[model samples]
Target: MGIKNRLTVMSFLQFFVWGAWLITVGNYWFGTKGWSGAEFGAVFSTLGIASIIMPALTGIIADRWINAEKLYGILHILSGLAIFYIPQVDNPTLFYWVIFLAMMFYMPTISLSNSVAYNILKNNNFDVVKVFPPIRVWGTIGFIAAMWMTNLSGNKASVNMFYISGFASLVLGIYSFTLPKCPAQKSVVKNASWTEKLGLDAFKLFGTYKMALFFIFSMFLGGALQLTNMYGDTYLSDFANTPKYADSFVSKYSTIIMSISQISETLFILAIPFFLKRFGIKQVMLISMLAWVLRFGLFAYGNPGDGLWMIIMSCVVYGMAFDFFNISGSLFIETTTDFRIRSSAQGLFMMMSNGFGAFFGGIFSGIVIDKFFTHDGVRDWHNIWLSFAGYALIIAIAFAVLFKHKHYAEDVATVTH
Candidate 1:
């Protein structure tokens, strides 16, 4: 296969492995298992927990000992086995631990996939920034395709999603071995310090006031990122119980409606260079924070009738809200951090945002909905969404006031792949 074909397959299966389960797992928990909000919250928290430690560890191994492609293949195979076992397990507690382990193996591969693609593309003398996004967009397409498959097959609420994921993962794992090898590079210093050896030296960035604030707010914004993923489709589907919306198009095709976010994401990713070049990271991120406010607030007032447009708009804005902070924030890290500790720095960024942010968001948001927002099993979804919107507003204001960024014209240089 040509490099492009290989990358297309890699990209497809990369997210296919995740898509087979991530979005619809809530359906399985709520619809099939009839589990409590708290239990489900705990289950999702595993992603955050795994994010805290796994990526850096795997990154260390890839850089110093194992070949990146081999490690990526092995991890995917192991994660596939974990997903296969998911169907057999019935206990929520056991399931949580098992999924946590699976996430530990899986989360690192996200970053590893980037590394694998980067190395291969660079080896072939391709422009990474330009070439990689189109290939990576296929990952988003893969995610949407998986969601369509799960919903259409009537497997969204069953353990069958895991089976589909497991099979795809197995194929991807075997295919990985055939790719160009990404052997580990020897360290320049044989007797590096423990911190340098493990890449823990990246933590020293915490001493810089501006970078510290950026990371801290990144955590808060990260909390908002998972909220839509956890509940957006389920929230829309909730209208199914109401007589007025029972037969609505959205109720029947919630996953497809949800996919507008991914479609929007592809467009936004393409536009990143223009926005970064024009606005700089600080202002761009501020726009992202405000965009989240619109994302949730529109959801608060939206329903299946006249309000459906608001919901769709919210999904549309999510592309900016997510890509602005995530991709832009990553680029910001790349620009600010030293080359030696860059990988570890990026891992730390993920740890704060996705790891800690998601853990707290899942548990707290669930508690708020169950305890304070629920009145007789039916949620006060409007108020819940409003509260989220309010949170976004506050975070945006705080970020604008506290973090000062000086925009350098040259800083906006477009990265060509």
Candidate 2:
């Protein structure tokens, strides 16, 4: 295979491992096990905890000692074994530890994949900026494909989904061993202070008021990103309880409907360069926040009967809502931070958004739904969505006022390369 094709395959399997279980685990927790909301929240919090620590440790290993590709393979193989074992654990506590181990091995591979791909591409004289996005889009497609397979096979909540993901991970793990070599880059490196080595210098950027405000808002907006992932599939599957809409297409094919968001993501990612050039980072992110408000509000009013379009539209807007913040935020960090601490800055970004943000969203949403939205042994999903919509609106308005940026001509020229 061509180098690009090889990278594309690697990217696809990376996310395929995640999509198989992420969207539908709630069904298994709440519907199958009849677990409490607090327990489920604790289950999901593993993702945040894993994201905070694993990536840095793996990066350090890849930089100093091991070949990146070999480490990547080892991690995936261990992760596959961990995932395979998930079906055997019945208790929440044991389940947490198993998945935590799986995440420890799996989470680091995300960045390692990027590093490996970038190193290989640059070696082959390819442009990382222009070529990487198209390859990464396939990862989203892989995620969508996995979701569809789980839903269609009626295995969304079944332990078999883990088996399937494990099998795929095993295949990917073995395949990774055959990829181009990515040797350690310790020859030109020098010893440094602990803070410098750990990328702690990025923390100094926070002393500047503007960067501090931007990261603060970035953390809040990250909270919004997880809201849908935690509940989107469960919400659609809940429609099966309604007699009138029980047989509707969405309830039957909830994963396929949810896949539209990922499909839309592919297109929006390509459009990002244009939007960033035309509107600047501040405006692009503002547009993303407003799109998020619409994403949730439409869900509040949407139904299987007359409002199905609203549900679909919400999925469509998800592209803008997600890519606008995530991709742009990464670009913002890239442009603003010093090169030496850039990796750590990116880690901090993921820490705020995916780590703390997702942790709070899972726990907070669970409490709110349990306290206010559940009654008579049924969840009032409509009102629950409306409340979420209101929260998004408030965040959008606050973001608009507090985040100040000017679209100077130089802003367009800065990232043109």
Candidate 1, residue 120: lDDT: 85
* lDDT per residue (tens digit) for residues 1-417 in model 2: 999999999999998998999888888877877777766766776666776676655655666567888999999999999999999998888988998889778877776777677668777887555676788788888899899999989998899889989998998999999999987654433676676555456667778887887878877787788778888888998899999989999888888899999999899878877787688888889899899989998998898889999999999999999988887777677567654444456656766677676667767887888888888658887887888888878888988898788775455443323
Compute each candidate's TM-score over C-alphas. 0.94, 0.90
User: Candidate 1 — number of clashing residue pairs?
Assistant: 4
In terms of lDDT, the poorest run of 10 residues in model 2 is 408-417
lDDT of 1 by residue, 172-208 (tens): 8888889998876646467878877765677888899
Candidate 1 residue spans exceeding 4 A from truth: 412-417
Report the CA-based lDDT of candidate 1 relative to the real structure.
Answer: 0.83
lDDT of 1 at 107: 83
* TM-score between model 1 and native: 0.94
Instruction: For model 1, name the residue pairs that clash.
Output: 127-417, 128-417, 129-417, 130-417
